[model samples]
Target: MVAFTNFAIAALAGYAAAHPGEKHDAHKMKRELVARDNAAQLGARSLASCSNSASSQALKARSIKRRANAVKNIRQKRGIKAPARKDKRTLEDLQKWEAVNHNMSGTYNYDMFTSIEEVFSGNTSCILAPEITNGPYYVVGEKMRSNVKEALYCDGIDLFLEVQYIDTNTCEPIPAVAVDIWNCNATGTYSGIATEGNYATGGYNSTYLRGIQLTDGDGVVSFETIFPGHYGGRAVHTHLLSHNNAQVMPNGTISVWNSPVSHIGQLFWPEDLRAEVEATYPYNTNTVALTTNDEDMWSILSADASFDPIPQWVYLGDDISDGLFAWIQIGINGSADYTEDEYYGVAAYLDAEGGHSTGYTIGGGGNGTGNGTTPSGTPSGSLSSALPSSSSA
Candidate 1:
């Protein structure tokens, strides 16, 4: 029931009049549809290509970022310096320097022995007394006037020694150095079995006389023991010295063992003490204690002067009834300055018995009278003598 407009009615009437009963062009319609589809496919392919290009560019950017990060890390590590490593080396150097110097640097006075060769050559001028051996008949008794409560009927005065060394510049202590000591007991008996004995018998184990004590860091050492006894043919006396070894070289440098000897000489006791000790010995049966200055051994030698008796500077003090104690200070060169040449030489002489000389004794008893057994159960005479060289090195 709808009525057509004039335009629509006219168009339909015109189309029907112009081509009445004409067939449509189906081939042309199909060609036009196929062309339009091809254009649409081309546009889609262009868009797909653009998307793939953008993805590739993004991946390249990520790769560049990773490379930049890696470079930055490398630069940072290389630029940094390790201060801790340098500091560790510096600390090690400082420690080595301290050990070498021992803090000494200056001129110091010390006693030098000129006749060391003569002393070791069996020269009797330095010998206080000839070595003695027999003492079975010597009398042992208590004297009311004796200084010590316990007294042994012997020929020598008992001597106790303490030796030490110090750095003059810093006043620091020295270690592992050597010390040599020699003394006569109340009746003129040597500490070692260098002679004979009546009661105790002279021996290395006999504590009555003879000892060596090394100093500690404080530069102090104390020997709590008896004064030496005297024997016939020698006067009351004591001798001591500090010693060290050095290395020798065939050429270039001369090195000292960095060890120095100081304060060498003998010590004399009061006349009263000498008289009391000498009054009870077998040597007293024939002779008396000679004046220290008058004795041939002490007279020919001045303290640190002549070869006789090797005069030692003594630090005299109150008499010890229980034991005689003595000490001395020595100056030594630290190890740092030592060279191979200076470090290879022997510092002291060997005893007549072929032992490294530390001291000497005239007579009292033979070796092995006292505690002849060592802690290791070896005989004291046969035990190894491996004491340290210096108090400090």
Candidate 2:
């Protein structure tokens, strides 16, 4: 009886030791399963949040696109035709009407109209010239001649131009014209600002870095300046092209003078620069950044079909350290007679680094008031009074 009792006790102890390890393993596995489930729930929630934000952004973009399309339709309904070439005239002939009118008035506030030196501060000095060309190539001549320069800054970039040509019919290119370029410094602040009866003066008294150049035969123009910085509410861009002209005849005969024909437009940076700029502000909130080759409000409205894939007439190059340089082409059509083909006018091209390029229409032949006004509230007919022409290369 004693030996039987001993054997029973020993067997019970052995079994107890072996089962404890198995129980511990089961507890560990249960904890792991609970952790995994929690992680999955968190991941799903994050994904849902991202999806909602993207949907909201897409809706906003679609709304803007619809509005732009509506504007295009309205212009078409107005019987606006594209511009084409007709006659040619000398600079004196083009200026004849202005000489006679002498009463011709334009915006001349210290804020809007300043000298070239005031526009380009902290940059080098340079000059751009214009030449003449033929066919679609004439657009290049216009751009090459315009002494407009693009500057990049922290707040935003500025494009300074003396002149630009906008076809009244199709809102396309008008060649063989000069444009003056100028803008604020790197901080997106313009020159000649007055505060508390004290004027804020920095660079040249006459709009710094501002200069004029004529369009080439191919309707191209060029400029010398620095890379502009990005500002709030807009991407990195420039302000340029205040005055532009359109030729009605090939022999320099009948010409339409659109003085102070404000052409306000801007150039955007590449994806890399855009990303950096958006990180700054209001732009950061924009979800469109996710998409490649995104277009802004101005781009969709002013872009032309011919400017696609980059215009051959446009060119861009720079020393990087010293300063930047750019060239654009403008083509003017519809001098002799307005035709459907001529109504569309010509396309301008731009060439920049990284193979990035874009184009916009030149001559939209519509007689409308531009944005610039004199200090006395008199409207200026200068091309600079409206949206300036733009190119990205």
Candidate 3:
């Protein structure tokens, strides 16, 4: 018995020396085994008392998973300071952006829009794409051509404009819609006109950045154009007018700006994108002062707001130099069942259309309403009221 005691004491000392942090010694373990266990039976109570129990780890794991599930449930239901899905996504948010897939640095995306808890109070709705004054730059009865890249001195940035039209009430894609789009060249000059800021194009009258196209079966009108230069008062934007049931003329001309319009609005470049375009080429050399969206008093997406029906823009391309595809969702009130090549008027009939005749050929007075800056080097808050012309195309 004395030898056994001495042996036990020596083992305990060795264990202490090896494991300073361990509170349990060999004697304590032996005592526990002898005091509690019946060699034939192990009780559940004894297992529960163990320090490194599997049950304890499992309990902690379950608790963490439960908390995670609770958080996910709250988010799904939008019960917290999260905006309901209905608040942000209307029936028209089905327009999937298909483009070159540019990396959007500091840009807006669908994820960010839906994640925000508060619905933006501003006028970004599919119900109504805002319409502003056609501005002073619209060329009355401009040619319905695609290649508007005429200005040689213009430092050009390629732009692919995509617009998706949706039925306002049904939120369905409205097919066979005709759209007319126009903007200025890099030097703040417009095509098919002879005016101020147009001196770079020499003495000849020209039209550089203006064209028209009809929507495909998906209710989309895609344009191949260049990034417009900012001029006197307005920020960078594209003006568009849409006509449902509008006819596509044989020569590729669609006369619909004078027709009963289904939708009219503008597409905007993100302010950051603007800074980039302005830094290069003709944009950098433009004499017109730069303008911003806030300064332009252009709050509404207005008019050609496409299928998704908001100011959100998707720029597709790996690099800005390779050009980018920009998209907008527009809403229009029309019939889904209504299928016909809609005619605004015969294009041939408007062959003689010219002279201050009002269609969308605005600008000459430069009243602060444009996709560019005003001539006076000051921000003009908004476009001037479109003066009504008695003449028709």
Candidate 4:
């Protein structure tokens, strides 16, 4: 529903935004991830892939050992020197440091890097991050809001998703890179999809559990959602779309796509967690035949396979009811041209828009009311402007 005032505004007058960068650290971080995390993080796992024989498997084992040793030697050589430290550095610089450590917020163990390699793990050209299809449920004109739960919602375990956008080339965080996320409700029904089978909102137009935010100073964004329900055909997952740049406009929005790097991906939950969430209220109500993680229909989740999209392992609290956190770093090709996938929003707000920025008051410009933990580093604000910047872990 467009407000009358929304129609009156003429093209978001004088609104332009520029993202900060820390491209300098890219080369070193890139080298370290390739030489170290690839072999150690992925090791050897049973994969459903077709390109292996006993001879190839043995050779691969030797290759991994050689790479692992190379990484060990490199680390031993560098151990005499203190780790690189940044002081009074830009937010982008801080993000680069955390990203290189494989810890988005410096809170998690170094395994974050190990988890990242799983996505890029294997003997294939995963140079471009895998792109998943945008299902029919996606709707344009969704409010640029944060709290995605609607009044009419199902019972499900609470899910809090935190994402960091890294520059694939530098393996560094990309401050202000953009991402949008949407997922089904507790009963496996999307908020905006058409009424076909059991989805309640299929006939009604709604935007629950759907929102977009740009990465903050740490190349991070956060969303509060539910552990999604598994639909009949797909695994229990949340959908995410990413871009290198984005801008909001009064008449419309504009997106800058790094097609060679533009990404449409899904994030899945751990099977154990899924079983617990499903046992809860509305999830158990879902009537569709459940597809456990063991099912191989929607891309296998094993680590050793070539890069197709896969679910991320998350960091969470003691109980399933407590919120959960997940992180994934996208590997991208910077020099490659943006082609193939069309930009998500309308294009052409291109660099011609002045770099000078202007801010508008939404809900009368009151500061956000949530605790100081959102991505924007500020307290929560009106639904349209509450994704406050924050650190990642």
Best by lDDT: 3
Q: What TM-score goes with each of the models?
A: 0.34, 0.32, 0.52, 0.51
Better of 3 and 4 by TM-score: 3
Give the least accurate 10-residue stretch of model 2, judged by summed lDDT: 125-134
Lowest lDDT 10-residue stretch of candidate 1: 101-110
Which regions of candidate 2 fall more than 4 Å away from where they truly are? 1-175, 192-206, 242-264, 273-295, 303-325, 331-371, 377-393
Tell me how candidate 1 scores on lDDT: 0.30
Estimate every model's Cα lDDT from 0 to 1: 0.30, 0.27, 0.43, 0.41
Residue lDDT tens for model 1, 1-393: 012234423333332211111122333323332442343243333333442355434533432343233223322444422111100011232212111111010111112212222211111112111111111111111111112213453333333344344432233345533433444444454433332332235343233333333344444444433455554433455544333332222432112233443333354443344455456445365443353333323222222111122221111211222222233333332332211211111211212233222221112112322211122332343222322123211
Better of 1 and 2 by lDDT: 1
lDDT of 3 by residue, 50-123 (tens): 31355434433433343234334433443234222221122232222211112222232223443222222111
Instruction: Specify the poorest-scoring 10-residue window by lDDT in model 3.
Output: 340-349
**Clash numbers, per candidate:** 82, 152, 40, 16
* Shift of residue 192 alpha carbon in model 1, Å: 2.7
Ranking by lDDT: 3, 4, 1, 2
**TM-score winner between candidates 1 and 4:** 4
User: Can you tell me which runs of candidate 3 are displaced by over 4 Å?
Assistant: 1-128, 145-147, 151-154, 195-205, 300-318, 335-393
Maximum-TM-score candidate:
3
RMSD of 1: 50.6
Q: Write the per-residue lDDT of candidate 4 for residues 1-393, one digit (tens) a residue.
A: 112122112112111110010011223323332432343222212121311556434433443343333333333443423221112112342211111222122222222234333322233212223343333343433455555666677457765555555444443445555576788888887664443453444333456787766667555576767789876655677777665555554544323322222555566555555766888887888788776543322222112223323333333333445444444444443232322422111100112221111111111111232121122332233222212122110
Local error of candidate 3 at residue 360 (angstroms): 9.0
